[model samples]
Target: MIWKLSLTGMKTRLRDYMILFSGLAIAAAIFYMFESLATNKEFLEHSNTVSVVGIVFHLGTVLLGIITFVYILYANSFLMTLRQKTYAMLMMLGARTSKIAQMIFIETFVAGIAATVVGMVVGVGLTALVNRLLVNQMGIVVSHYTPFNTAALLVTLIFFIAVFLIASMINASSIVKKSILQLLNEQKTPTRFKRNPFLLFIETIIGLLSLAIGYYFLAEIVKFQIMGLAIALVTIILGSYLIFHSVVIFVISLLKKSNAVVFKKLNNFTLSQLSFRVRDFTQILSMVSILFALALGALTVGLGFRNQIMTFTNTAATYDIVLNNAQKIDQQKIDTLDPTLNVTYDQKYDDTTIYYIKEQFDQHPFEQKDQSVFLSGEVNDKTLKYDAAKMEQDEQAQKALQDLELPEQKEKQIKLISQADFDTLGLDESQLQVINVTDFTTILPQIKTLIEENEKNNPSLGGAEGQNSFSQKYYVYNLYNTFFSGFEFMGFFLGIAFLTMLASCLMFKILSSANSDAIRYEMLRKIGTRQSLLKRAIFKEIGILFLLPGILGSIHVLFGLQMFKNFLSQPYHNIWIPFTIFIVLYALYYFATIWIYTSIVLPKEKRN
Candidate 1:
């Protein structure tokens, strides 16, 4: 009988269930997405840059889990509200308390199961879509990536089922705390407007002080490493909550004192509604702002890291191509391509030419790179000179050989050959090709193919297929692009997931209490207030709510990106991309909220 009643309740409140379902499905889909990426061992192992992609993704899992934990609480509270009246009616008719507990448990479990099924389907679709966009828009090639994973699917199911079961148990335990009358009176309660000026002032001061200290610590990031991150997280999160809770209301109260603005038609009502909504909505506002900051900061910093490849490569070397043992066909191919910059070196090595640069070749002095190598953190004005090496079999000489960047060849040692020995021993001739083009990226494929073909025929060149023909810029670009591309993929999806949850939370906070506003709007209509005027009030209220969080969030992003200053050349680069995305989506959600709010308060004919 309880199961039937629970199913009936679900059928009656399908709209509320849809809201609950969508949030759950989106949350589950994102969880599965995170798990799939985090668990892919082959993908992380192949990344060229210095990072533990697994640890990073696992950190992402923890962050998303925290967000989901909060979301489930909100979801459960909404569910309780939806069932309050039903529970009240049941109790008045003498339904057992144990029976009521059973009903709530059944309802929560059923909803979780339904959401999981729909969510897995959505998760698979999102994975494919995200992969396609990364490849098409970001120019990344993902290998051994499977959108559908049995392990991820199983983990997602178990996690959400556990969450739902826990929420149900918590709700079931609370059944004894409320009386029949209290449950029935839940919907009738007027919204509370609580204020404490002294407390508010103190909180505002503390929030400001904490934020200042956080910014100070952030400025000197190298000093504080892990401790700095901890202080910053705690202080900023606390400050944001307090700022929204107390400071925002204090400012709003000041605006209400202005007769010029308050006396305008329906302006007073709008301000009053905003003031009431904000008093209790501070934590929600703060969470939204923090989520926005994180999403935008991730995207901006990710772009900066991705672009670092191009920046490092461009300034690292002069010539676009460096070929060893240039053959007749190689020069023919190099000439046909028409390099704007060319330098040829003709030298005779005393021994094998591949392992060393002849000391006698210094007479014809070839230029070495003026910039630092990719893995090295600094650049020097030092030029490559083989004569500088001690040439002895001592520790210092071996150290000098190991540190030589002139060869730039992976794992190759250089020993200088004497001119007298070069003349004494009859050695083979070798040629080097240093060629530069207007653009290296566009013509890289052709160059790579040409090198591979040459290596296929002449084995003595001893160059790897992809490693041959080094263009300083193109070389670094090829090396680091894959890593940054993966980072960008993670950033893009994490941002989307956060923004989606944040938007849904804001929307639900407004819509769940929409029925309560109907009486207020009807009373206004009876008192000769225009429908247009009432709608303007709704628009003003929701718009201000949406804008407030976003404005605050953008402020956080401005300073938050400072933490990444050391990791990136320009921490704030390409920031507008994420900002534009946030603004557009937030605006649409705002409008949608207004439409729903107005529809509930005012009928179609009245609104028209």
Candidate 2:
């Protein structure tokens, strides 16, 4: 009988169940998607620039798991609220408390099972689609990436099922603990607002101070590094919450104090409604604000990393191609490149110094834009110890020598010697060839092949020991591409997931109480309140709810990006792209929330 009644309740409140199921299912899907990426050993190994990629993704998994757990718990609260009246009536009619507990467990578990099945299927498709899109958009070739993995599937199944079971058990226990009278009176009670000026003032002060500290730490992040990041996150989160709790209410109270503004048509009602909603949903607003900042900040920083790649490669070396230990076959490949200018110099290195053949340099006369090589002038004893600090005094020399592609050139000195002196060293001779082509990007594959061959004989030319070695130009470029592309993928993935979950959270919170709010809207309608005015009031109320968090979140992002200044060449480069995407997504959700909230709470016209 209880099972039949629970099923009947579900049928009657299909809209509420739909919202609950969809929210849970979306949460589950995102969890699965994240796990799939995190657990994909092949993908991580292939695409990673650094070794810590696995650890980073694992940490992301834990954070996302915590977030999903909280979301499920919050969404389940609405389920409990929807069933309170039904449970109360059952108990009043002599239904056993144990049977009521069974009903709650059955209902929650059934919904969870259904959402989990659908979520996994959706997760698979989403992962594949997103990975493909990111690969294409970033022009990165990531091999060994598979969206469907048995480990990810198993982990998602186990994690979500456990979460759901725990939630159901908690819900059943809590429902049984409530008295019949309390359950009956819960929805009928209104959330009251009481002003405490002293507390509000204190909260406002604390919030402002916390935000100031967070901004300062972010600005000086290069100095403080990770510790600064931790402090900034805590202070900023606290400030956001306090601002929503006290500063929002204080502003609304001030707006109410103005007689002229209050007397404006429907303005008073709008403010009253807005004030009530703000006071009620302060914590949700704060959470939404933080989520917004994170979503936008991740996307902006990710794209910023992408923009820095080419800029870094260009400035790191002057020539399009720097071929060290150049061979005859290498010259053959270079001749195919149709270079505008080619400079070849014989090089010999010993324990502490490199020798550049002066006769070869004199014949070629390496020049760039009417600037000759800095080592061209005569030196005492025909030798010059390479001093990077002094070399910077001549920009052309700094740029020209950087193209030599010698390992640890900055730390080593260079000597210019005649043929007789060069033979006296008895060191092995290698040729350094610097070539420039009309287009650099079009010849990456050719250049990459040369780099690979060079690295085979000379492993030191790679990114391993000499991280800043110019010989590792190709390696470093690919390293940055893969590293930043991972960040980009993670950013978009989490941004969309968090935005969806947060939207559902706010939506479920508001719509679950629509039945109680409906009575008020109906009473206003019967009192001859125009439908258009009511619509306008709904617009104003929800708009303010959306606007407050959005403004604060954007401000947070504006300051938060300062932390990435050292990591990215231009942290603010092309920042408007992410902001535009964020605004569009946020606006869409804002309108959708207003539409749905209006449909639930407002009284429709009695048309024929």
Candidate 3:
């Protein structure tokens, strides 16, 4: 008889059970996808550029675990509420408390086991699909990647089982404590506003201060290092919570006091619902804000790094194939490039007497070495060294250098010409004109190779020592690859983390408060309040809830990105790409949340 009753209870509450199962399944799938990249030690070690990437993944797992744990607890609590009245009836019929407790535990465990089995199957399939997409997007073959990680599956199952067992015990204990009368009368009570102006003021001030400190640390990330990152993170999280707790109330109060907008149209009803709803959800609101900031930051930085790579590649090279010793085969290879290719050619030389009279004067006050070979086929290692003692002792080098003191040796005169001496160099008229410094820097690699070939063929012209002299004349382009790599990697991870947290927090909050909302909607229907009005209220309420976090978080990201301007060559370039992507994702989640919330909260109305 007890088993029959338990099975009937499960059948009756199938909708609620389905919600619980679906939520867990989605969470598991996302977790598995993250783990596929994070847990593969060899893949992460090889592909990841950030030194602390493994640590970041560990932290991500911990955060996701906490969110999932909380979600499960909340879902179980709702299930307990649904069973409370039935349990009371059983107790009245002389069923033992211990028997009821045992039955409840069995039900909870059954639900958990069922959910886990389905979730794991879904997770494994999703992991395989996501891995394939990521591989294609990145254009890299990742070996040793396992979509079906036995360890991840085991860990997820164990962790979820423990959570369910703990929740079951709590539910069982609650059943033991509650009287039959209280259980029969159990229904959601309307939440009341408990305003304390002084507390609100204090919270607002503290929150502002925390936010300020977080911004300061973010701005000076280089100096304060990891300590700053930790502090900023903690402070920002705290501040966001306090802001939701205090600032949201303060805004609602201000809206209520306004005569023009508060009492106008549906604003009064909408604002009332927002105030009451937000009052019960201060922590969730704060969490949503943090996630929004993280998501936007990640997408922005990731796209920025990609843009930088393209820019660097474009700026470094002008021609597809630039060769001084171009053979017939080499020319054919160049011709086989993309049909849209463009090419240009310059003269070839075997020996060149390039003069650096101005550089000698700049280096020495007296005329000792009047000329230096700026380019040669065979670069001599010795010419690269600067002999300060020998340069200082020459009186003629001193006299030549007295009036015009140069900033650096590289900026001084360095000359290069074709090895074919002026006549047989085979130079085109346009190529004969000396290239501008700006343009020359872009083609420096081609120029260096050309010089090397010429000196190789004509060894009499500065060969070994001259090679070193040529090396000293040129500057190596510093693109700062290290810095961009770090930003790109961190950005991608941060984006994913933020979106996951945001969706979970908002989804949980909506679902948790849904039971109360159902009654409110029912009351509205019984009265003159139209079904349409109730829906509009729901839509407006959700809109405000989602909009506030996104707007404020975007503002924070804008100011935060300003701090990176000094470091990035084109910090603001293509910034819109990330923003657009964020908006599209955010909007989809918002619409999905509204649909889910309505399905859970709205009564079945007749279609006109």
How close is every model to the real structure, measured as TM-score? 0.84, 0.81, 0.63
Off by over 4 Å in 3: 1-20, 38-119, 137-146, 149-198, 258-266, 311-329, 335-501, 511-515, 559-573, 596-602, 606-608
lDDT of 3 by residue, 1-608 (tens): 76777778888878667767666666666565555545656545553342234454455556566767766765677678778888999999999999899878887888887877787788788767755654543333677677888877877788778888998898889887889988877544445566888999999999999988988888777678799878888988888888888888888888888989776756787787676645557766776787788678867966676555434433332222222223312334333332243322222222332222223323422212222321221111222222334444554443333211211221333232323443444433211111112343455555455545644643433432432221222211212233344345446645754665576567656666677777777766677776677778888888888887887688668756755654455667878888898888888778888887888778455212
| Winner by TM-score | 1
Candidate 3's TM-score reads 0.63
Alpha carbon lDDT at 206, candidate 1: 94
Give the candidate number with the greatest lDDT: 2
Cα RMSD of all models vs. native, in order, equals: 4.7, 6.5, 10.6
State model 3's lDDT: 0.61
Better of 1 and 3 by lDDT: 1
Question: Candidate 2 lDDT, tens digit per residue, 1-608?
Answer: 87888788888877767777886677677777767766666656554454344454565567668777877787787778878889999999999999998998888878887888898889899878866765564345678677887888898889888988999899999999999999999766655655798999999999999999999999898789899989998999899988888887788788889998888767887777666645458878887788778777867876776676666555444566666677643468778888997877777887777777666665655533222221232111222322333443565464457545555554556667787888787887887777777776678888767666765655666533454344345655665555666666666656776676677767776676778777777877888887887788778877887888789999998988878766665778778998999889888888988878787787454210
Residues 1-608 of candidate 1 have per-residue lDDT tens digits of: 88999898888867667777887787788777767666655554444332344555566666766777677766666677768889888988899899998988988789878987898889888866765664444333567677887887888888888888888888877764699888878666655555788988999999888887777677667789889988987888888898888877787778788998899988888777676646447877888888877777666666667766666555555556655556545467787777887765544543323233455344434445444443344333344432324343344434433332223332444445565654555666655656778777778777766655655554544443233424334445655555566566666666766777777778777776678778878889999998778888888888888988888788887888777666666676677777887678768778877887788888787766
Candidate 1: RMSD to truth: 4.7
> Relative to the unseen true structure, what is the C-alpha lDDT of residue 119 in candidate 1, on a scale of 0 to 100?
84
